[model samples]
Target: MLSIRNLHASVDDTEILKGLSLEVGDGEVHAIMGVNGSGKSTLGHVLAGRPGYTETEGSVQMDGQDLLALEPEIRSREGLFLAFQYPVEVPGVTNLEFLKAAVEARANHRGEEPPNASEFLKQARALCDAVNLDQAFLRRGVNEGFSGGEKKRNELMQMMLLQPKVAILDETDSGLDIDALQVVADGVNGLRAPDRSFVVITHYQRLLNFIEPDYVHVLVGGRIVRSGDKSLALELEEKGYRWLEDEVA
Candidate 1:
């Protein structure tokens, strides 16, 4: 549902994503594996149109629309979601208030009516249970004072609520424990549908063990050097990026 071709992006005049290309079909999960500075996270940020991450060349299309032409909020309304590696805290905005606004904004974009406050809260509470978050957290500031795992779960919660057509998870497993990891994976798996796709950007194979991506790609020097089935992830785990680096070299 998303297509990226020869994408080149830079930050502060330093290029990060160099001639990167990827295609994600409906219902497919693609895992991007790479060491630090390999542009894994940069890919996600550029796709989501984060400020200062400039897309210098190439095209990104979401279901035939120019993804790069849209502003960040417009991109979200167009069904592109990016879950950050480090979720920032909004001290004064309560989680419930944030989620309600997001859901309402999406509804308005789609020309649909948003749920009533009570019903919305009910659904939010259920989602909190699903993500192992306490209902009380809905009253807390967005990700404020939340532990690392809790923040990740909060991201997942937002993803669930947004129901984006394409979700780019930027190292969502970085700080999660085994149990918390499983919860995040389960939440992702639960949202899998015939029309939805996910781009899971991660470093290790452990996250793959849970999300089970349909395709695993090795990114080196800001470009995807190899793509394969899940077994490729196992290979990377066993031998690390050195073998792949030599092959690419």
Candidate 2:
């Protein structure tokens, strides 16, 4: 569903991603594991077309269309979703309002009219239930007073409601406890379908235990250096990333 080739990206004046390349097929989940400053987050930001990151070279394509050629909003509307590691808290915007606007925007992109209030609410309630979030959360400002885990759950809730074709989860497991992590994982697993794909960017291997990926990639020095199955994750966890550093060097 997504292909990135020789993607070199830099923020401000410093280069981050250097010739990163990967492919994610439909219905496949790929996990990107890397240490801090290894460009894992940069890859996600670049894919979503976030500002401050300049693509020095390479191409990112969704299906067969050039992804970097489109704007950020267009990327989201065109079935691309990125769940940030730190979800911003909008003081005045209720979660319901935010989600409705997103859902309507995506619907309009497909030449379909927005769902009416009743229909939208029904879908919202279903998504809320799927994420194990309460209806009360819908009435609150987006992540205003939410705990860390609550924020992650809210992010997953948005992903479930939007139903994007390719979802990029950037460190969704950072602050989640075991129970909360399972809830978020369940929400993600429920969204798995034949036409959907996922790129899960994380630091630890625990999340992989919940949502086993089709492939595990070790990203070092801004490039993918190793690719394997689930067992690779366990090996990385046990032996640490020294082997990856050696291989990349």
Model 1 regions more than 4 Å off:
none
Query: Candidate 1: deviation at residue 191, Å?
Result: 0.6
| Candidate 1 TM-score, C-alpha based | 0.99
Question: What would the per-residue lDDT of candidate 2 be over residues 169-205, giving only the tens digit for each residue?
Answer: 9999998999999998888898999999999999999
The local distance difference test score of model 1 is 0.96
Residue 112 shift from truth in candidate 2, angstroms:
0.8
Which portions of model 2 miss their true places by more than 4 Å? none
8: Cα error in model 1, Å: 0.3
Write candidate 1's Cα lDDT for 1-249 as tens digits. 999999999999999999999999999999999999999999999998889999999999998999999999999998999999999999999999999999999999999999999999999999999999999999999999999999999999999999999999999999999999999999999999999999999999999999999999999999999999999999999999999999989
Residue 82 displacement in candidate 1 (angstroms): 0.6
Task: Provide the overall lDDT of each model, using Cα atoms, as 2-decimal numbers.
Answer: 0.96, 0.93
Which residue pairs clash in candidate 1? none
Number of backbone collisions per candidate: 0, 0
Model 1 poorest ten-residue lDDT run? 42-51
